[model samples]
Target: MMKKVRVERDKQGFWTHPQLPEWDESTTFADSKKWFSEKGLDCALVIMDGDLGEQWGNGEIDSCLAWEPEINIQDAYLVGIWDTEDGVVAMFAFPQIILEDSDKAAEFKTDISGWVSSDGRFYGKDERLARYAGSTHRKCDCGNIIPKNSYCNPCAEKRTKEKFLAMPVVAWDGASYIYDENTDKYFSNPEELVEHYAVDDLDSSSAMLIVCKPNYARQIEDDFWCDDLPEDISFDECGGVEQETISLLNKLNEKLKTTVLSYSPGDQRLDQSLLF
Candidate 1:
């Protein structure tokens, strides 16, 4: 009999250890490969445990998931070995010995496990192996793995949504913009935000907008709008704000038939909404 520490990949995609979070975290296939480089052990050959065993007879699997050759199931706790891109070489990390004509026997417990007499396999679930090796499943041209159908469910739905997005839409004129890292794009329209950076506010420091008209002289003498007091500005250019100087521009532009200026907010001479 051998010992086995069962691990399960959780719903959140984490392989947790029963007792040690840190230890379990290190067992990630990616991390396992990284450890070798960090410790300068990349050149070391892996001395895998367990060897090809004799066959086990019918009906004696005390260990969980013990490989049953009669059914082509694994015998024991086979540690799935992932390759450079995962699914490299599959190994049976099992070790319990079985007697009598065993093609391949997996132990629920340990000693070590054996590999087939060839290469290029990774220890993974049947579905996973089927997906990667095209053993029992096929890949969509979209690169989605599916048991059947021209497209995976997700790919089909994605295409449908893409068509929906392609439909013409009324353009919105909003000033804000967002940057998408995945696509390296800048797009407006708040409805399309996804995975945006956490920067809540963008500052355009002391920014102001001045509405201008077409065909105007570029350097025409215009009133300067400043948040702070300017030393050389004439009071007339300040919209003649003083009640005494208000007559300088005139109460109305008689030629244009529009109010030249209305200093009072309550002035109902013109429709404020229409002015906008």
Candidate 2:
């Protein structure tokens, strides 16, 4: 690992780079790339979300860095910054081209996995590296070992399907109930029974009279399946409402009302209230 590079901003919103003082907060990504190109480093930008690096000291914000593909250069460059016991620290790391010789550059590229340090040294593991590493095994956001990139296998597939085909399934992997495509069933992710229900065709905003008509609520409560739900009771059908779901909606509505109370009726009011 190398030492960390330092970055700081003055009171005037001017960001400073210890290694690359010529570049600052005002510097655009294109300008930075051009600067790196002038310095003979064929680099690309790698912007990682702060959450991914939070476990390592990086703030939960977006961090951008220039990734050099041809690392054969002599000078190591500033990578990014992270928080330390003292304060925010800038870091640096070597690219494959600079670290390895021509014969080993390819192998280095294959195994180029490392973390960022404020002292400008490469640490252990990094999510950004793992994403491009093309490794067979990956860890999901839920801490489960997955087979694909950032998310678990099923999650990745579900996300792809949802994005590509606009699937109506609401992914509830973080919730108590998780959908299982294997058996077309729902499973309890919780350790014990929590008195939850799976609602079907329950529209929250509509507030239709039929919802309170006869034994509709009772039928819904009665048909609530903890393990699995019927096919008709999906996001596409609506009308689903569990006890907690209803409570959440009520709370949300109350909060919305309170928020509306604080603001003027027209949309133009937001322009006055919110900061640009």
Candidate 3:
């Protein structure tokens, strides 16, 4: 995957691409089209909140990029910056009317799928998060109206990295883990912990970054890696992860339902449940 040039927020809490011309009220649809074409980009982008993208995706608004007479370009920019999901996406559109006739460039939420995103990520929450210190709006520490008690998502990630680097020990796979004070041992991964205790201990009060499979890892992240998991569960990305997890869980569930344990508790043998 090509690395995405994540846009940074200026002091005013605004995100601007160094390569693209900034859009203002005086700008026009022709201006937006020019911005798209100048970058040799393929299309125009709209990013409004809620059902707007859904409506457009289902083909409800084919001619939604309606222009206005006074400030088509400026209002579009304001609406996008002030309120929207995927701020400043790209699109391939031409005004049906002449440049002078329309006031706005894109009157509705635009389709981001048509935009030029060389990066693998779809430009929405991820882009919005990155634009404002891993936050969604201008109110955050990066650029938000109200400051939050907890660190923004990106800041939390930085904190996690700092903790990981500061750690003095790690398991064979090189992952960081918490020490079991009672047992006087620490596990770098979940595979070691699961066998030593009951199933509930896997995700109990103890928090850790667990690697179930080579490609699958889940971090019980909160204040610290050892902090309790958040009470309210929220998904990070659901586009395809939901299906992928469902499939993987089904396989794991099938095996668990069929497999039988041969070793009793505390047996001096390999925990063969991992083999199944």
Candidate 4:
């Protein structure tokens, strides 16, 4: 015949074992079976106080358990059981560190029997416990508020590519290029002069040189070359070039002249040769 077991709390608010000297304070779930073996107990059961539900703010009960310092208590629940060889065991007391409210505690008491079995095991109330356990509310690394089901709004927003050509361009043969569908043309360096100046003519080989405004003697040398051409071949003289190439070079020259005039405080001699 199965023996009947009873559990009672002591004056110090700990549950007393019926047969064992005292409840093992260092017990863990992994060692529960071993604890039974050493103490000659068959099985055990756990009971939780209803009050702990309120103490776990944000509907997070698992956090309380995970954050528990002592193994004896977890989220205000009384845990541990000892079943004897004759199928009789006593309940051990292990309470959560935080206390719950009276109203919440009352609700738990009303449904305690439904949740706890006569054999000292917990059942039938896992849904409610899981609802509280799975609650997650926190901020993401990008300073965006994250909810239970999704990431932070700001983080999602930041991940989107606003620009049409958001893909990173890997430089092959020391040249980086991106195809712009808006203009139906390829930009050699989209992040530089073309984007900043809003000019479409400049290819990848455009150069910026500082020279005097009226320096006709110091002509701007056209030394820029394409990747496939030899060192002797100039950008302008390259065969099968696009019409925009000349326009871009002219614009670059205009910018260089304007920049030089702004910095040259006095009337400077214009080297005509420098304007190559």
- Root-mean-square deviation of each candidate, in angstroms? 25.2, 21.9, 25.1, 26.6
TM-score of each: 0.19, 0.20, 0.20, 0.17
Off by over 4 Å in 1: 1-5, 8-78, 81-145, 149-154, 157-161, 173-276
- Across 1-276, the per-residue lDDT of candidate 4 in tens digits comes to 112345343432334334443545465645764555443233435433344424343344433232212333222222423322222123433311111221212132245643432223444555344333333333468755334455665565456323212433222222323333233344334344256334555442322211212222232446534556666787677666676977787777766654432221112211213222
**Structural RMSD, model 3:** 25.1
TM-score for candidate 1: 0.19
lDDT by residue for model 3 over 42-147, one digit each (tens)?
2345454346446645656533343211233311222122213333233323222212112221121256532212222334434332233322113344542322
Each model's number of backbone clashes?
Answer: 22, 22, 21, 29
| lDDT tens digits, residue span 105-146, model 2 | 122233546543322334346534423342334346666643
* TM-score winner between candidates 1 and 3: 3
Better model by TM-score: candidate 3 vs candidate 4 = 3
By summed lDDT, the worst window of 10 consecutive residues in model 1 runs over: 263-272
Q: Name model 4 segments beyond 4 Å from true.
A: 1-109, 112-129, 132-144, 154-193, 196-276
lDDT score for residue 184 of model 3: 40
Best of the two (1, 4) by lDDT: 4
Judge candidate 4 at residue 8 and give its lDDT: 48
Model 1 clash tally, residue pairs = 22
lDDT of 1 by residue, 66-169 (tens): 22222122233433322222212332332222211222221111232322211234334343332333232355768654443234776766785464345443
